[model samples]
Each structure stands twice: as structure tokens, then as C-alpha cells.
Target: MPAPPPHSAGIPASRRAQIGAGLSDSLGVGLGIFPLGIALGVLVVQAGLPWWVSPALAIGVFAGSVELLLVGMLAAATPLVTIAVTVLAVNFRHVFYALSFPITRVRPGLPRAYSVYAMVDEAYATYALMPAEKLSSARMVTGQLAMQLYWVGGGLLGVWVAGALPAPIEGFEFALVALFIVMTLDALRSKREVPSALLAGLAAAVALIAFPQQALLAALIMFTAGLALRYAVTRGAAHA
Candidate 1:
């Protein structure tokens, strides 16, 4: 497919549409992340943290789970060194993402570095929904940056909203859970990818059970195992 409009570089519509769609599409993943964001805001307010601090963390750190974890550590009066180390451990997957990212493909300079920083999992997933040719590295950077803005916007909004809410939102946080389950079911409606999905799910479950505390390690092991299984299947098919 050819490239999208110049204005639609990273996205596919007007600036308004770009922002709207980014916010809309991210609702599901945002839901999955919403509870955590709210919780982070609540904690920050309770801790008497400066308002600027939450936005800074959301922008600078940009990882949902890691931020939540860091807030938890802070709540416990954990040492800053320990909190920082734990944050690094939780986010080590980004190192792998950086290594695998098309370093040579993306343009060199501030844009590329900024893009790498903004490339969160939800943005990656959204990009995967687009065609490859339309997904220029520069466009990916643009899209990723847009998505980060949405994330930060949501978190900042949540911080203020959480402070004013009459009571906790409770189980409403499962909205994303339901959406993802639907998306998974929709994807699985076709029988072709079922085997791979099953294999990956089983591998992930086993890894999670075996490595409870090291989520990043478990995910890596599961991903490697799944890839190996795919490779073996392909080889067997070639011989057959």
C-alpha cells in the first residue's frame, strides 16, 4: 500500500481524528491500565506529592506497570535505590524492544530517540493493526508519540478525577479486560492462528507459574519457547 497523507503521517486522519482515534482505540488497553493510573494518582495525592511529579513520571517513565510498581514501593517507604532498581527490572523488556527495533531503519537524531522512548506496548499493538508499507519507521515514531500523549493525558486526567471522586471506582476497571477478551475471541474466530495461540498461552502460563516474581524473565522464556515451537513446525512442514 502507498503512504497515507502527509498530515496523516503516523496516523490516518486529521489532527482531531488522530487524537480522537488514539484515545478511542486505546480505551481497551487504557482500561486495562486505567485502574493502575487511578491508583497511582490516589497514592501521589495521599503522599502529598507535587502535581508535577505524576505527569513527570508518566511522561519520563511511560510504562504503566513500572510506574504503578514504583508508587507501591514509595508507599512502603522503600529506598529510592531499591525503587529505581525494581523499576528497571520491571521495564527491562524495553531493552529487548530497543535491540530488536530497526535501529538502521529509523532516521538518526532526536526524533528516533524520542520515538523509542514512546514506543509502548499498546502503540506497538495498534501499529500492528496497520499495514506494513504504511508503517514507515518515521510514521511509527509519530504514531507512538501520539499514543504516549494519550496515555499521559489519561493519567493526568485520572489524577485529578481520582481526587474528586466520591468513592473508589471498584470493579469498573475490568472494562479493558472484557474488551481484550472480545478482541482475542475475534482474532481466534479464524481457526488458522488457534494452534499458535494455544501453544503460546500454555507456554506463558507455565512460565508465569514457574517464575512468579520475574515477570519479564517469564515472558522472555515463554516467547522463546513459542518461537522455537513455530520454527519446528515450519521445518517439519518443509520436510513433509
Candidate 2:
């Protein structure tokens, strides 16, 4: 049998427009995510997981960080309930992302579903940077589709590359730590966030001193509660 054609000349004109828009919009983000996806694919294989898990998580879960952590948990035979809770806690921020996301701008049905499914951080950032007039269903959906393609394809390629490795690779776990550090530094750059950063540092210190074995989760809970309480007190004092 012959291989398929290189181009989408056989596709309809309207569909082609969607494809073109998606490809163009995805260019900047695709460059960044493609390598990360490949790294994730490598991580999965290094974690002793089957290669297909990478694409499965990318296509199904669509969360790079959670998926990377999950591959390790799964390899360790973590319980389903524990995994579910961790996923919820880690991705709870997406609920807030959905509030301001341009999901409504896309046409309803499959395109809309695709928009929601592909609503990653990069997609949200892309939408934010795009001109209001350029926002359209085809552009939005196709952009997401292109990104998924890069991720899924890179994951498959990573698995193949991992299979060729002579021995187990080291240093993959540092990716998660590095990402969190970058994000923390980014969050701390704003003047208004300085107080919150200080509070977080205090919370981390307390959690570490108190719950050494569960410092991360304890610190997150303590920090969130402290922030909430502080907000409530400030509001009450202003009203009084």
C-alpha cells in the first residue's frame, strides 16, 4: 500500500482554513511544548511505563505536569482514590482559568469540545495575546488540534528514543522541581504578590517544621487557608 499524501489538498476549503489558522497560531507555543512533550514521553518510559501511556495522558488528561507526576505514581502502584484526589488538588486552578477563557467565542459542538479539552496554559496564553478581532472557532479549535498533534507525536517519538537508550537515564525528576521554582519566581515578581510570597514562605516553614513527611500538601492547605482568612478579615475591617 502507498503512503498518504503530504498535504491536505483533499480536504475541503473551509476545513483547510481551520487547519491553516490552527497551524499558524500554534507555531510559537508548539516550539516550546513539543520538546516538553518529548521529554514527558522519555520520562514515562524511564519510569518503567508503557510508551502508550504518554499519548493516552496527553490526549485524555491533557495536563503535562499532572501526567508526569502520575506516571511515577502509577509506576509506584498508588491507589486510585489517592490519584483522584491528587489530580483534583493539582489541577483545581483550571477551574479559575475556565472563568476567563474564550470558550464561548468558539462555535458550539465539536469545536467547542475541542476548545475545552485543549485548554492548557499555553492555549490560554495564546488566546490572551491574540487580537480580539482574530478570535474565531476555526482558529481556536485548529490551534488546539495542532498543539495536541505536537504533544502526541512527540510522546510517541520519545518512547521510541527511550527504547534505544543503553541504560536508565537520570535527572528527569528535576524537571518538575525546576518548573515549580520558575513558576514561584514568576508569581513573586509582582509587587502586590510580595506579601503573599512571604506568607507562603512562612507557611512552608511551619509545614516543614510540623509535618515534615507531608510538608508540600500541608503547606498548600495552610497557605490557602491563611490567605482566605486574611482576605475575610481585610474585607470585614474595611466594612466596619
Candidate 3:
């Protein structure tokens, strides 16, 4: 008889299927992530940082937008406190992401810790839209691992590519903005999310006008409050 299929050796078919689905789900987001990772690596090198910084940020920081910002900050020799605050402001949205992320599905221990550590935007968005019954620890962790691999691998490649270039590439910094725009557009695809998007725009405009010095933090606070109020009203109406 022929050798048994891979899944039949030890792993259950259901688990193997879940792992496959997870990796499959990561592909679409990985396309965007990999390119952005390349941009980040190129940025680190062009900023006069060591090549190792590329993969360092990819593996250590692992937050794309924050990593991009860190490159410029580190190049300018920004103060540690300033860097810390900026990172907190930029990544504070992750706190909100955690509210709805199905992290509890992951088993406790190293697996759960890794899942939490790797909970990037792409993973959050993917899990948010997935049906509950279809979710499993294997799928969620596998998908996140795949996305991170893409980012890490892309960063390494970018470092090499940047080294070969005779001159630095301009506008790699815009990659972070582009990534957010794509995410916003994807989120807005649902009709129900339109109101929230509008609220975010309004918050951003008001913050820019009234708190230009702290626009990002201000906008996040305003948008979060708006979401909370909207939720309360909707809940009340439902109960009424």
C-alpha cells in the first residue's frame, strides 16, 4: 500500500483542514503585508540604520505602521520617552481590536501568547468576519504565523534589494498610510460600517482643526467615544 497521507499519520483530518483554511485566509492579506514589509526594510536601510534593523523590527516590534515610524525616529535619535508615547498612540487601536478579536479560541500557554503577540490588523480583520463555528485555535494561529512569515521574509529580501540599489528610494514612508487606506476601504465594504467610517472622518477633521498638535491621539479618543455612544443608542433602541 502507498504511504499514508500526511494528516493520517498523527494529526486529525479536522485539524489539518483548519490549518489549511487558516493559511488560505492569510494569502489575501499577505499580499499587502509582504510589500509593506519590503518598504519598511528599504526604509530602515535608506535611513542609515544597519541592515539587521529590518528583521529586528519585523520580529521584535511586528507592528507595520509603528515599525515604519520607528525607522525615522531612530534615525533622528528621538528621545526614548517620545518614541514610547508615539508608539502607544499609534498602536492604541489594538486595544479596541482586542475587544472583538476571538483570542479566547486559542488554547492557553505559548500558543495563546504567540497568538496575542502576533495579533496584527490583518489577522484581526480576517477573524472578525469569519463565522464563529468555523473558527479554531489551529486555524487562527496558523494564519497569523503565515502572515508574519510573509512580513519577515519580505523584510529580509528588501534589505538585500536596497543594498544593491545605487540610490535610495523616496516615498517608502507612505506605505503605512497606504496600508491604512486599504484597510479602511475593506472595512467600509459593509453597509453597516459606513456610519462608523463617517464618524471616524468627522473625528479626524475635528481633531485636526482643534488639536493639531495631538491630532492622532485626539482623533482616536473622539472616534472611540463616538463608537461607544453609537453602541449605547443602538442597544437602547433594540431594547425599546
Candidate 4:
């Protein structure tokens, strides 16, 4: 068979289409991410950090909530050991996310590496609900790249806005909480995983009460154990 013709831009037509579709898929998520990125930038400036720190975090960390937390920690001059532990505790969930992410669809080499590196929560959620047949390396990578662009662009814009403002804004830090709440609500609506949600809440409450100093780490551990036990029982019942 003859090879497919190239797009006017010199890329293969099919490749171009895949890239376009990926960008289109990212549009909705980008809308949400952009504002949060802006918030991060504003927070950085308000915290008295250099304007460049916003894009640096966006690129280096790429974890929204963690970046926000880091801003506060950096401003407070948090100890290195504590910061390291907190970052690990906060991002440990990504280890689980990797287990189910469709990384096999991507080609090996730099493409696969980039796909793995860019597998943020938004990308994971987007792919989890996507039909398996529709997945492709180009689409996944392009979508991730587009989301990052939104974040970087928003950060720059926000820096400009913050510089123009007369005074620092209060309550901008709440954007992190607001984003998570929206994500949680959306997940509930889509999967109706009420039991899992309830378990998470219980774990958080217990951890807060019992291990206040280590609440985040303790809650994550408890939640993971609860999920494992639930799965084992459910599987055994099915077999029985």
C-alpha cells in the first residue's frame, strides 16, 4: 500500500488529526488548570517569591496541590527534611495511579518517558474514562503537552496581573482546596463510588484525631489498607 500523504504542515495527515484531537480533548481540562496556574502565580508573588518561581514550579513539580503547599513552605522557610517527607507523602498516590495508567499505548524511548513523566491526575482521570479502543500515543502525549502549556501560559499571565495589582490578594490559597473539591465532586458524579468516598472521609477523620502531626501521611496509609481489605473481601465473596 502507498504511504499516506503528509499534512500541509508536513506532518502525516493521520498524525496531525491525532494531535488535533488530543488538543481538543485537553480544552476542558485546560480551562480548569489555567485558572489554578494563575492562582499559583499570584500566590508566589503574594508570598514574596520571585516571579520566575511560578513557571519553575509549574515545570519542575507539575503537581498543582503540592506546588501550592511548597509555596507556603518555602515562604515559611520549612526545613529540607520536612519538605522532602511532605512531598513524598503528598505524591505517593501517583504510584498507584501509574499501576492503571495506559502507558503501553505509547511508543518506547522519549515518548514513553515523557508520557510517564506527564501522567498527572488530570491525565489519569481523562484516560481512565476514555474508551480503550480510542487510545493512542500521539493523542495522550499531545493532550498532556497541551495541559502543561495552559499551566505555563496562565502562570505568566498571572505574574503580569500580580505585578499590576496594588496589593496582594487574600484567600487565593483557597484555590487548592476548591480545585480538589471540584475534582472529588466530579468523581462522585461519574463513578458514584460512595463507599470509597466514605472510606476516605473516615480515614481522614481518624488520622486527624489520632495522628495530628502526621495526618496526611497517616490518612493515606489507612485509606490504602482499607481499600486493600475491601478488595480482598469482595474478591473472595465472588469466588465463593
lDDT of 1 by residue, 163-238 (tens): 7878756654344355446767886989977876787577668767887665434565566668687889889999
Q: Against the true structure, candidate 1 has what lDDT?
A: 0.63
Per-model TM-score versus the true fold: 0.55, 0.83, 0.73, 0.76
The RMSD of every model to the true structure, in order and in angstroms, is 8.8, 5.1, 4.7, 4.4
Q: What TM-score does prediction 2 earn?
A: 0.83
Rank ordering of all candidates by lDDT, starting from the highest? 3, 4, 2, 1
Per-residue lDDT over 23-61 for candidate 4, one digit per residue giving the tens place of the 0 to 100 score: 998999998899888888888898899999999999998
TM-score ranking, high to low: 2, 4, 3, 1
Q: Against the true structure, whose lDDT is highest?
A: 3
User: Candidate 2 residues 1-240, lDDT tens each?
Assistant: 999565566776766776688789899998988888888888889988888899999898986678877887788787676577678777887788898888888999988987887888888988866776778888888888888888888888888888899986888767767877887899888977887888889998999999886666677788888889889988999999
Off by over 4 Å in 1: 1-39, 103-105, 128-131, 166-240
Stronger candidate by TM-score (2 vs 3): 2
Per-residue lDDT of 122 in model 1: 71
- List model 3 lDDT by residue over 1-240, tens digit each: 998677666889999899999999999999989988888888888889999998899999987688988988899887676677778877888888888999889989988999999988899999977889989999999999999999999988889889999988787667667767987999999999999999999999999999886666678789888999999999999999
For candidate 3, the lDDT comes to 0.88
TM-score winner between candidates 3 and 4: 4
Clashing pairs in 1: none
